[model samples]
Target: MVLLLFDFFFHPFVPDVLSLWHQEFDFYTLLLSVVYGGIIEEIMMRWGMMTLLVWLFWKVAARKKQVPPYAVFWTAILVSSLVFAVGHYSVTALETEITTPVLVRMVILNGFGGVVFGWLYWKKNLETAMAAHICTHLTMQAVLVISTILS
Candidate 1:
């Protein structure tokens, strides 16, 4: 909910990453985003990257605790989110004619989503995070479709 609101409210009034979303808001694209962005991205960012970082940090930085410390977990979340943001920025740049504002927004928004997913993965299970990710994309697609219908 927070991430959705953030995207809806924070998107630039002028040209930005929303331009890419508006341009590519088709059934196929939506489906791809729901599946790839939700499933694959969660697997990579949360399951793979974040988990690895937590373990590594726990071992190295947190002095090999039996369980990961809070600091270790948070460090993992922040680093993985940064990575996720950079990955999105790189890929989005290739597809869109991104200005600085667009690129920055894309990085920040995706990074915020990454933090959400990472938190979910830590608190719940990977599946829970995956479901949230999928739902986010589906909800966005639904809004786009409804707006198109109304307009």
Candidate 2:
């Protein structure tokens, strides 16, 4: 997908925030990061923020007694994703020398994840989206472990 491509290309450009893994690897540090950074952050961003925004929008729409089209949902996803990217940018800038490409990739990837979450929301429900988000975060932890072991 376009979003995926953009993310892949741009992620390296995003300034690194919190260089937790410097020089030799630390197993405990990785574990802590997986617990706090991966799990906690994913829950807060994808499930908490994304889901809450959708519900709030739905509530507002229901109050207006207007059932907007799926475009409304798409818009919400896009907006939330942008905000998420911006938040990451701030964090990244604080810790790393973010290049343009890194920032672009980070934004693109987050946006793509938002789209998937939005789709999950439409297909199954908000809870399903949260599950998907958590699964993705778990997978990232697995990736980190595998990479560390391999290298």
Candidate 3:
């Protein structure tokens, strides 16, 4: 909700990575984002990367356990989230000047969401994380469409 509100209200000041979707709102693109962004991102970031991190930590650091320790788990989440944030910045890097503020904002916002999704993946399931991510994109798209209509 906070991320949605930030994208809605302060878009002019701190544009989101998907701000282009607002300018050129296409149903197919929105659908693809909701579907693929939710599933694929979770698969890549959490299931793949975070899981790998945990496994590596378990194997290398905590040789006694099959599962990672709490510290290792949290560290994996942070690292995965940072990687996720970096991935989001790829599009922005092509057009905008990647400044300190932009980098900070990207890490803070996207990384926070990534961590939440990562936690969901850890606690519940990958499907839950994917559902949350899909809902987030849908909500953002809905707001963008409505704001466009109003304007």
Task: Give each model a TM-score.
Answer: 0.87, 0.62, 0.84
lDDT of 2 by residue, 24-79 (tens): 35567556655654456556665677667766777776546466456566666777
Clash count, predicted structure 1: 0
Clash number for each model = 0, 8, 0
lDDT of each: 0.81, 0.60, 0.80
Q: Which stretches in model 3 have alpha-carbon errors above 4 Å?
A: 6-12, 15-24
Could you tell me which residue pairs clash in candidate 3?
none
Structure candidate 1, residue pairs in collision: none
Identify the runs in model 2 with alpha carbons over 4 angstroms from their true place. 1-66
Best by TM-score: 1
Identify the runs in model 1 with alpha carbons over 4 angstroms from their true place: 13-17
As for candidate 2, its clashing pairs are 10-101, 10-105, 11-105, 13-101, 13-102, 14-102, 14-103, 15-98
**TM-score of model 1 (CA atoms):** 0.87
List model 1 lDDT by residue over 77-149, tens digit each: 9999999988986677676677777667777788888888899999999999999899888877777776666
Q: RMSD to the native, candidate 1?
A: 2.1
